[model samples]
Target: MTGFDPAAHLSEKLLERIRARAAAHDRENTFPAQDLADLKDAGYLAILVPTDLGGAGLGLAEASVLQQRLAGAAPATALAINMHLVWTGVAKVLADRGIADLRFVQEGAAAGEVFAFGISEAGNDLVLFGSDTDAAAQPDGAYAFTGTKIFTSLAPVWTWIGLHGLDTTSPDASKLVYAFVPRSEEDDGRVVTRDDWDTLGMRGTQSRTTELHAAIAPADRVVRRIDPGPSPDPIVFGIFSVFEVLLASVYTGIARRALDLAVQTAAQRRSKKTGKAYSQDPDIRWRIAGMALAYDPLPAELASISRDVDGRADHGTRWFSLLSGVKHRAVTMAKRVVDDAILVAGGSSYFSSSELGRLYRDVLAGQFHPSDPESAHATVASAWLGPIEP
Candidate 1:
């Protein structure tokens, strides 16, 4: 990890290439194949793997910064790639606590294998606690998964997908199985990739629906089977921490881009009646300042929380409250900033082809991710007020 800088790795030239393809990918609703390949070739995928395993050995702090930079250039690419990083980041979290269970994920990522997150399902809001997918245990201890996963990002290229399901057939009927299913065509075509990713924005992510037909996770690969619902398990903590931090980083990046574009637009566009640039208008300047004000605290909070996760700084039960709060704040701030930016950019930005317009749509998605506004509010309320009587 010596002398390793994540920013230097994602060079300006690389970002330019990614940025150039973003519009085309969005317009065509295609996955960013070239973007993923370039990031992999640049060793960006192994940022969280330990140095002993041929990776940068970076931590969540570095990953958060890198995510912000990547999202600024191409939000969809950053987001799609985030699922893979979350696994590796979680591996790092576990390793720091002397738990070597997920080391394989780190190794595989270092080896250029893409890992997508498949925890999301249609109308299932239990998140990490419970799953609608079925995981039937075999004699060999492996689990065969059968269910549909919605918003499976990096669908076209993932080598492994980390998912969870209910294992009713196991000794413990309440066991919630957590495991990785390999992407293969064997076993009479085990996994089905649905071509239904058309969306308002972040179109290049290709986050399609997946139908699993008894896809098996080998015994050795079956990571954890915790009791359904929340517990103090490392798997739960790891996923929540990594997912929230990285997701927040991506949205913060979007806000940064929108704010920058607003400044640029204001500097160029003029007030026809006043015979002056919009940048000179007091009202426009105030709007830009408001955007900046909303955007300021998020990156700092993202950095601090990520470093806390890396350092294993103890927040006890308050961690859930903290993580959810940061995610909610970042998303809300980003959305507000983007809205203000659109006002600054005026009518031209309203066009479909405008970057701000795309960002407007992408920022809306932040509301739909886990730790959503409603969930975040509930988590925070529970943290302070305690849970209501059953």
Candidate 2:
């Protein structure tokens, strides 16, 4: 419970190494394998697991801080790592609530097994509340999932994928099945990862499409079977809370980096009119100050909510709204800051080689993650005014 220091987990040296490779990975449209390797060596994948389980035993708050630092250096690396952390974070949440179904997730991560999130689907607006994938139940209480998942981050090296599908035939009929399936070639083509991750930004994430053809999760891996659409299941809460908060942390980190770059650019660039650093220019000073103003509140906000989650504060039904709201704000603020940074950095930022230009592209990815703008507003609106009338 002492003051948490992100540097202890992600050293400046390691981060600099990761940062140095970011543009190359982005340009090549490839995964940050060395970054992942370095993180694994640092035991970052197990940061959320309890110390008794051979991890750093940090809470979501600490993990959030660490993610921010990591993202500041190499956003795509931090983002891909977020998927692995999500499962471990969920395991911590479940363990905190006395649900040990996912204890193996904690243990697996500590042992170097990489877990990827696979919940997102194409055209499935219901999100965590619904699934387009089919979850056919087996007599032994296992389930076979069949569908395609888009934006499956860590697609290249994940050892296990945590995903969900709809169960329509079980007597529990119409329940959403949350399960984990290993990434094994022994499945004879049941699990397929598509090598198609070309995108405008966050290219190092290599988040590609995945096809599951009757991908089986043995009984032990079947974590939850809950009714779809806004249930009170701990799994739902754990996923929603951790996912949203970590996502916010990532974009907030992006904002922090953008603001820092703007400061550096302002300090280094000379204004022709005054022969002084742009940092002293009235307009440049105003823009940098404005960027800082926008960026200031994000870390505090992320810390407060993340601590609430770690402390298990009873936000009650307001949880969804609070989580989504922070994520939405962080992303929008990051985009604004990056845009202003581009202006302050002037024409140099327009080139693809500019770090600001790379950041400009990377920051755009924030809007596409879960609890998207429309959904975030809807969740908050429902918390305040209730659902729309049918």
Candidate 3:
């Protein structure tokens, strides 16, 4: 693993192709189907699966680096693929911990099957700990889900959706059920995807709303059923750790791209007063330096935490805070960098066609993801100050 480079898997030529299509996909508000095809061909979907399972057998640290590279080219494409990677990463986590419940996920990813994360629900702030959807248990032990999931990334082409719901009627009344349901025509009217993904940015994700009408997850697909509220279940840890690290990696990549753009713009643009490039201006130099100062530590932090996850290093109860804190810092830093990059580029970046303009919009979506600003603060506060008295 010493000399492993993400570039070997995600080549520069492939990234350029993905980068070239990004603007068109953003402008048209369409899914990056070709990007998905290329990534699948590159074996990126199975990067976390074991080598014996027909995958690259890379660890989480390597996957984080690769995701950062992907995001630098196309944020929306990288974000959409993040969902698929999440499932595979979680599978790796479980397998590493001697739990094989999600082995199917790894196998499916190795076979080029796309898995969409379906945990998000409108107005449900409980996240992984709770769910608004109904998990009606059938006599055969299969559970039928009935609810709507928002921001279902890769919605147009997801082969299986990994989701959770509350099982209120089962003997274990308040258990939270985690399961995976296949996306197939034979589902009857169980699963419906709304083509309503037009957004401010990250439009290429096509993260549409999904309505589930008794979408059935067979018994084998029901991976976990844990009590409501915080639990030490491996599934919870697996999802949270993988999701946050990959998310941070994406935003960090965005910041890296923004900083690079700023440097390029500063070097190319001439200053009216000095008749020299803006890169020579004191103010411009300071601004780019500030952006660099902010961007410098993110990759190191991502690598450290991702390696901890891969190596199964124990962090006790500090895991949540660490994960949320990195995501919070990465997104905020990316927004800052993109904002400064636009300032460095001047009015040229204000136009819709500008890459900075797209980056500006794409970066804004970071705040909307889980472990958002408020949640991150709370998690950190709880970890440091201990939970408030009931």
Q: Evaluated with lDDT, which candidate comes out highest?
A: 3
Q: What lDDT tens digits, residue by residue, belong to model 3 across residues 35-58?
A: 999999999999999999999999
The true-versus-predicted C-alpha distance at residue 101 of model 1, in Å, is 1.1
TM-score per candidate, in order? 0.98, 0.98, 0.99
> Could you arrange the candidates by lDDT from highest to lowest?
3, 2, 1
Tens-digit lDDT string for candidate 1 (164-259): 999887554579998998887333688999889989888988999999989998898899988998888998999999999999999999999999
Distance from true location, Cα of 337 in model 3, Å: 0.5
Q: Runs in model 2 with CA error above 4 Å?
A: 185-187
Give Cα distance to truth, residue 225, candidate 3, Å: 0.9
Error of 3 at 379 (Å): 0.7
Instruction: Indicate the worst ten consecutive residues by lDDT in candidate 3.
Output: 181-190
lDDT of 2 by residue, 1-390 (tens): 477777889999999999999999999999999999999999999999999999999999999999999999999999999999999999999899889989999999999999999999999999999999999999998889999999999999999999999999866458999999888832589999998999999999999999999998889999999998889999999999999999999999999999999999889999788899998999989998999999999999998999999989999999999999999999999999999999999999999889899999999999999888999999999999998999
Worst 10 residues of 1 by lDDT: 1-10
- Taken over the whole model, the C-alpha lDDT of each candidate is 0.92, 0.93, 0.95
Write out the backbone clash pairs for model 2: none
